[model samples]
Target: MDTKRISYLYDRYQSNSLTALELEELGMLANSQEFDSHFEVVFNKIWEELKHEEVHKMGIEAEQAQVDFILSHPRPKTRRLKFIHKIVAAAAVLIVVFAAGLFYRSFQSAQTMQPAYAIVPGKQGATLTLASGKQIKLSDASKGKLANEAGIEIIKSADGSLIYQIKDAGTGTSGMFNTLTTAKGETYQVRLPDGTVVQLNADSKLSYATSLNAAGERRVELIGEGYFDVAKDKAHPFIVKTATQQIQVLGTHFNINAYADENVTRTTLLEGSVKVFSAGTQKMLVPGEQASTRENQLSISKADLESAVAWKNGEFVFTGQPIDEIMRLLSRWYNVEVEFKGPPTKEEFEGTAFKEKDITEVLELLELTGAVHFKIEGRKIIVTK
Candidate 1:
């Protein structure tokens, strides 16, 4: 492909102005050896634009959506570019997925035989509990308007995520509250009335008011893990309350891991500032900093932000985490039981993998690392050194 055409396509992809057919054409071009031969040019263009930050998270995510759509649908034709598009789509996915911390499968070495039974990956969905204590399964909810609660309109978008809009700001003060919960092997995203977006991972729950309270504090209680992109409202601090601490932010993006089974609760700030209050102490965190709390005691330190927000961004990022920790996460997403063959080993691994891929792929990757091996029998995964 000519640089002029490729450059234009890349610009359109970045700006998200590309038509459906144009995106397919771009995906096809990106999957081509000809395009691969000149990847340096486009790669450099992207790096030049987004060198200081993560390169095109929105754009890459859009590309991922396209690739996923293409894969799930039947092929159109067997043209040269079409065949190349299918083959290169995986390669193209690696580029963007790796940027977001998903382990690229192409880099793995030869794999040993996987388990007899393979486990499919998790999908995007959750359950919503209204103030009346009625439960609405998001998967069962159709597209468009789902409900009107406390003057807040709840809609399930075409992409399967939930959106909330305020029908009347005057009615926003209602005491009615709603909750979103994700069961094991499921994940979801929902926008709150204040425009804050929350992505819930497997086995997580977020409870928030139908609208802002009279106290001027937009607070939400979280159990398990979730990522937040808070809309700016300095007058009303967006407070994320967990079992261990309260993270107060004024329009920021962050990730919090508050799972009960974990030893400590972690809050990682990605952008903007957050004040963490716990254990009778308060500390402010900047971008790339994390607050870890156990009991009432809290500590501040630099953290792996990528790993922190990996689940929200659709990947499993292990930053030198122990095998036991890894299995705990896998257990939630795969909805399976994990058993150790013997004593726990002191091995750590640093890598990433797509959360929506087969569980066998991850186990086999670990197996290849000489760290551990795995066997599957029904819904149980046995790990051995």
Candidate 2:
């Protein structure tokens, strides 16, 4: 495998100017394990030309797409290579280089037509409102005890996570509640008094009693999305209330997506059991099951756990999700407004992207599918066919 030839084919493919013969040749070369070392050298050279900042903007989805394209290339039926399995195994390592080459080419092209505005990804932060109506901006608050309410002491850890430490367990009920809210482009995690941990996604809120055991049962009202890890206390069950549904559990790990813009409230159980109540209907969900509630109707299905908690894990994992839904998510995380300029392209996107990438890079990854396009003007993202 000639490194120069490999580089030429890669450049042509990136420019969409590769001929049929060249495409086949490139595919064959990419399919061979013997040429993997040569591909690495060529790609490394290309990667060197990318600016340091641009290299950081590259995304995993783009790399995965390149790998998929290379692997899907038709093999020569008449010839069987003994190292075919080895080539398949090495594709992941090699394709990263190929993807970097693609990103470098894309970065060069982007420079010629850069958008007027760039939207950075979301960050870990939220606002904590105490029972007395005092609001503490967690993002700006120092790393130490922020407040003391009733018997709970609110502390901000070194890593920025909010913590509620019990000062006097017997001090009990104060008939007061505290709320934690994350605005657009922000997220947060908090450890409650009862040892339960709650992670709030962007554009979400969680309100709970200052003392978890004060009400006899641990109760919390949630808006938008949250991942809950309830502490076990058989005497006092954990309960989460959303707009359309209520989930009661002894001690469980689960996620609830109850955005008002969405039609249904989804409760996905990752561990233990939960009973979802909606209107007058109720359904018990086991692990790996999801309960969706809308009005008086409630249904259950196998849950996509990874997708359910992707935000909490700092990634966006879309599996055949529509363009509108994807943009809705992007709007929340990037703190941007989305407007569709034409009839929506019915394209379904499937990929995993890090939430840290700039909106431009994410949009570019989606555009690679040739299904949708985006334009940024100030804080607005205009979608087009």
Best candidate (score: TM-score): 2
Residues 1-385, model 2: lDDT tens digits: 6889988987897576888788668767766776657867875665444323343355545654655765577422221111112323233434543544443333333343246756789999999999999999999999999998898899999999999999988775748899999999999999999899999999999999898776579899999999999999999999999999999999999999999998878999999999999978889999999999876688999999999999988788887788899899999999999999988877677777788878876776665454566777788888887
Worst 10 residues of 1 by lDDT: 77-86
Give the candidate number with the greatest lDDT.
2
TM-score of 2: 0.75
Query: Candidate 1 at residue 276, lDDT?
Result: 95
Total clashing pairs for each candidate: 3, 0
TM-score of each: 0.70, 0.75
Poorest stretch of ten by lDDT in candidate 2: 76-85
Which lDDT value does model 1 have at 143? 92
